[model samples]
Target chain A: MRENLLDVENLTIKYKVKNGNLFFNRYREFKAIDQVSFNIGPSETLGLVGESGCGKSSLARAIVKLVGLDSGKVTWLGKDWTSSHASTDRKFRENLQLVFQDPLASLNPRMTVSEIISEPLENYRKDLSVLEKIELVKKSMETVGLSTSMINRYPHEFSGGQCQRIGIARAIILKPKLIICDEPVSALDVSIQAQVINLLKDLQKRFSIALLFISHDLSVVKHISDRVMVLYLGRIMEIANVNDLFSNPSHPYSQALLSAIPIPDPIREKERKRDNLVGDAPSPIFPPSGCVFRTRCKKSTNICSIKEPREKIVKLGHRVACHHVSDEESK
Target chain B: MNRLLEIKDLSVVFDTPDGSVKAVNNISLDVDRGECLAIVGESGSGKSQTFLTAMGLLADNGRSAGIINLNGSDLLNMQRNDLNKLRGNRIAMIFQDPMTALTPHMKVGEQIREVLDHHQGLGKKAACEIIREMFNKVNIPEPDRRMEMYPHELSGGLRQRVMIAMALICKPDVIIADEPTTALDVTVQAQIMDLLNEIKTEIGAAIILITHDLGVVAGIADRVAVMYAGSIVESGEVFDIFYNTKHPYTLGLLNCSLSLEKKIDFLEAIDGHPPNPNNLPNGCPFNPRCKNVRDICREEKPEIKIKKQNHSSACHFELGVK
Candidate 1:
């Protein structure tokens, strides 16, 4: 069996919010991530999908040590590195890279494309000379489909798609073992989004790097990911292989999310029955008592509201967190 | 033949430091009563600018030349005050971002009341009654409580519902929804699309939906018009545009979208990015990226020509008959 490259165990993240102005100062903790756990094997793409404010971004940030974890551990290559000091550790920073959403906003406006792509090498590779760094930058640019001639151009000069290519080039420059891409193509147009998705796939195959792909768009996730994980209100609802999760989703939330996506084909779209979950996601600050998704879940019952469902292995690799689903599987 | 809104040879130009930017080129289309016409394009494709000109909402530096006729009356030449009277009364516009479109300081109920007061000259009690009904029609729960809340206090989906309510409060003949559901999540987007479909059938108002999502367009729009670099490359029935595509750009868009039906190994992405509006290619804006480009494509621009019944394509050659 292939060993896991990254393992997250019972990871919990929280943010403190200050309520009641002026005289009475009251601070409350908002639990953004609730004991979420998953693992990614080397060279595998694990797609994390959830709606806005569902803690997908919080979880990604927590993994990279960009955000503090209140509880639990993040194991990298079978080594525990959950301490605050890990953020500054050279080995951790070099092996784990991140590609952000809003390509233009993520890149430094004043810096040239070359500077942005080679910034990692400057920090991590002190042994390399300036000339070597320049050569590496050029090669990285070519790998991401950017011409070396445009290396001196600023982020504002390039289009959104090209700007995204620059972002990809920077993430792949260090040849990291794992890269977490947070909504990388959501800001792009449909045609341009396809270009960036294809580029990521190509780079992944070439470098054999594991990816923690986070996105709200399910169709894009389905296209690029090897395995998929569904999150609802900061908790894992289901995780399985790409085909098994999409074809035979065990969790109710997974089924609703899949049905909500409108297929491009008109005839198929018309025939598809949509079981849309009503109402917006509840605020994480005041989430439902038992299950975080009980407020919006269609299949919720008294047991779903009384006690939180434990994660159960439905099949060899598929795991789901729903009381009814697990009961049916056991029966 | 009973077209409620007709635009003829319309062009929008904006004066900028770089030069005059042709936002929307000479394009003509019409919408019949109770029909939905979708304008699909990427950013800067001028889908939004087309209706902005129709509503007299273009910026000060922008200039438009064409006939915008509504019910046989030319709107381009009308006075600002006259146009203002017709705007919320006869034609209503729903913006992409409902939060910004709505008044933040004012209460949600008062915002809708202001529209009815200005357009219909209704009394306070009458307007309040209509506002409550409008809120319920759009499926906003607890109309009384929601009406008292501020715009920021509501969720994205509810804010959009309020925008739809305000648009419907006027009972306008033409409803132009510009990317109404783009800011919403998938489930909420489905809800909003379903709401729009319900409004189209019940109110029988001509709806013009401006969006980039082809899936949303296919589900709701009766007809589809595709734009590329300020020109309509193709306009047809939804079935024709999706299945029997003509323009290369349109084909590229359909091919590029990741399908939820089946997994595709490699997406056939369009070769290059969209051309800069300031420095578009001479003949056809899409010729540089077209796979079947010929010598003539770089010399003469092709006008939109009808290829089949209710289907038009702006291409030099027939799609499949090279």
Candidate 2:
């Protein structure tokens, strides 16, 4: 079996939300990520998908140590790096990187392309000379398909697609083993989105980097991911191989999400029957009892609301967390 | 042909400090009653500007030429007062972000009431009745309670529903929805698209959907127009544009976009970025990135030509031919 690059175990993240006026304020814990567990094998792409408020971003931020974890463990290559102090380790920081959603906003407006790309090197590679750093930055830019000549220009000078390339250049400058991308291409146009997706795929193949890709667009996730995880209201509804999840989704939430994606073919789009889920996702602050997706699930029953279903093996590499699905599996 | 809205040789230019920017090059298209025409393009392709010009909502630095004929009336040359009377009454527009488009301070019901009061001269009680009915039609839960709540109180999906309700309250002949589902989630987007489709058939109002998402276009659009560098590169029936594509730019767009229908090893991204409007290429705007470009494409600009019945493309060489 392939070695696991990153292993997340029963992770839970919560935010303290203050309610009422300053005089009578009460802090309530809002669970953003609840008891989620997964493992990413070396060079594997795992797509994390859910609607907004489903904790996809929170999970990403927690993994990168941007947010404090309420409970659980994050193991990086057999080393425990869950604490905030462990994230400060230079080796761990260099081996793990993150690409943000908004390309322009994530980049520093005042910094030039070369400066932005070389900042990570300055943080990690203290032994490298200035000339070597410059060469590395140029190489990274070339790898992401940005022109090396435009290194002196500011982020504002570049287009959206070019700015995104600069972001990728900065992320890959350290040659991280894993890159957690949070809605990376949601802000870009369709055509530009394709370009960035291709670049990521190319870089993954060249460097053998594992990716924890988080996105609301199912079509994109399906294109780049090897394994797919479905989340709803901060809870894992299903985890399966990409082919299994797409071809035979057992969880109700996954089925709804897969069916909701609009196909590009006009003839197929018209004829295909859509199983649209009714009502918006309930707020994460007060998620439903037992199964978080039970409120919106069409096949939900009394057992789903009364008891939280444990993860059950549906097949060799497929697991689902739903009372209804578990019952069917047993039968 | 029962054309409800017709735009003829329309062009929009902006006088920027650096130079003149040709935002919307001379282009013409029309929408018949009950038909949905989708304009697909990247950010600066000028899809939004074309309809904004038709709505008489251009920026101060922007100047528009040519005629926007809506039901035999030239909207481009109309007076400000006359245009205001026609806007939101005969023509309605739904924006991408409902939060910004809606009034934050006013009650949601009062906002819809204002549209009715201004256009139909309905009193407060009559407008409230109509507003509540519109709410029910758009599938908003608890229409009575929702009308009194502020825009912030509602969810993103509900706020979008309110926007749709306000746009439909006017019962206009044409509705120009600009990236309406861009701000929504996939599930909510599906809901909104279904609602829009149902409303289209129910009211028979022509819709002009301006978006970059080809998936959304394929679901609802009767005709598809692909724009590149402010000009339409291809326009045809939805099936023709998706299957029998002619323009290289359109073909690039389709090939590049990832679909849920199937998976491919690698996407064929169009090389190079879209050309800047102020400094477009001398010949074909897409020649620099086009795979089928030839020496002639670098010398002379290709004019829009008919490729098949009810289909047209602007390219030096037809695609799929050696």
Candidate 3:
């Protein structure tokens, strides 16, 4: 049996917003993520996908201890790490890393590529000799398709795609057990995006590193992920295997999200039933009561507005959170 | 068929301290009224520069050669005021980032009204009424209520709608939407694209859609021009570009594109990054990345050749209906 590498339960993150007022102290709570739960086994990928302000980034951040979680339990290697997991052991920190969206901005402009790649190694592995650290950095750089000769060049000298390669090299230099990638290829062009996605898959296989891939691009999430989870306004809409989720979506929101992706094949695009979502996503601060997606859902009803729908397993390993799914099951 | 806009051998080059960068190679294409033309390419492919040069919106250091005739009026040699008059009044453009395209301080209604005020010389009361009508036309709920809000007050999707409203407010004959939905999410992108198409039909305006997403191009464009290294390597109808591609670079791009319909085990990525405009390679410019690269491709450039009715491609090898 494949052992679970990391398990997250009931993860919730909220922020106190001022609501654009300075004189008054009236604040409202914005639930960035609510009761989100998932697990990743060794060398597995769990893709978190949603639009902006859906809290996918916040959830990834919370998992890496970059942000405080309002409520949740993070279990790593059978050990529990609560909301305030900062100041934890360095081993835990070394085992988990993150790759951001903007490659150029994520890297340091002043630091040389070699220095930047080895910075993590210098911090985590104090016992490793300088020659060993250099060797590891060189191996990682080559692994991400970066040339070993241009190690002395700065970030500005490289293109957007090359800078992202350097970023990947740094993330994997420490040989972390898990990596949370936050829209890593969103800023890259199509050709460059393919290279980076393939590199991540290759590295994961070679090193057995679990990945938590968060992206607004559903197509990209589908390309590389083994299991996909759809998030809508701080909540999980559906979680299923890649084939099942794309083949048959249970939730209305998931259905809309899938049908909305523009198919590259013109014939399929013309024939497919397209559900064009009208109106914008409501403000996360004033999200509707009960089901957050009720306002945009076609299957919404009085029951949907009164109570948040519990997750229902419609098939093996396919869970959907929608009142309509429950109604069909009851029928 | 009447040509709404015509370009003859248009090229744009920018002068930098390092060297003169040929951002746009000589290219000529005509747009008909009520037709959607898509210019598809990766970064540094000169897709945006071609339109920006024609619109007289190029940077100060950039110089463009050739003729841009809008209704037989020479835009390249026209007076500054005359060119300015033609802009936004007859040829409106929608940018990629909606927030940056709009003024942060001004209200949404005022921004739309300002366009009408400057172009049509209409009074505030009259402009505001027209702006409200446009807001409703774009499907923004509570048009009056949302109009008073500032640009940042609205969400990304809402801001894009306002941009579309402003662009269509003038009722221009030609609309150049340059990566307008790139910053938007998929769901909102679909909504905006639907609105754009619906408005295009209602207004009968020619839309020049410049984007990199093949899916977007396949779905919306009637004709597509595939660009590579500051040149148009292939030009054809949408069906030909997708179903019967004729260029090696275009074939590479189609394989590189991720499709939700047909699932492939691995995407075939074009090996190298887009060439730097300042130092483009010799000969075909795409020879380095071309899969079927030949000895002749490395020695001489290939001109755009007509292979079928309304379809042309630049390549040294045979390519058609593969």
Task: Supply DockQ values for each candidate.
Answer: 0.82, 0.83, 0.78
| True-structure RMSD, every candidate | 1.2, 1.3, 1.6
Positional deviation of B245 in candidate 1, in angstroms?
A: 0.8
Task: Please identify which of the two predictions, 1 or 2, would achieve the higher DockQ against the true structure.
Answer: 2
TM-score of each candidate?
0.98, 0.98, 0.98
**Residue-wise C-alpha lDDT for candidate 3, range A207-240, written one tens digit per residue:** 9898999998888888889999999999999999
Worst 10 residues of 1 chain B by lDDT: B257-266
Tell me the spans in candidate 2 whose CA falls farther than 4 Å from its real position.
A21-23, A84-88
> Model 2, clash count?
0
Tens-digit lDDT track of model 2 for B84-103: 88899989999999999999
Each candidate's B-chain TM-score, in sequence, is 0.98, 0.99, 0.97
Candidate 3 CAPRI classification by DockQ: medium
How would you order the candidates by TM-score, starting with the best?
A: 1, 2, 3
Model 1, position B305: C-alpha lDDT score: 96
Interface Cα RMSD per model, in Å?
A: 0.8, 0.8, 1.1
Order of candidates by DockQ, top first?
2, 1, 3
Q: Candidate 3 regions off by >4 Å?
A: A20-22, A83-85, B320-322
Tens-digit lDDT track for model 1 on A1-331?
Answer: 8789899999999899988789999999988999889999999999999999899999998887878899999888877779737445667778899999999999999999999999999889979999999999999999999989998999999999999999999999999999999999999999899999999999999999999999999999999999999998899999999999999999999998988888888888777777878989888888898988888887889998999999999888899999889677678
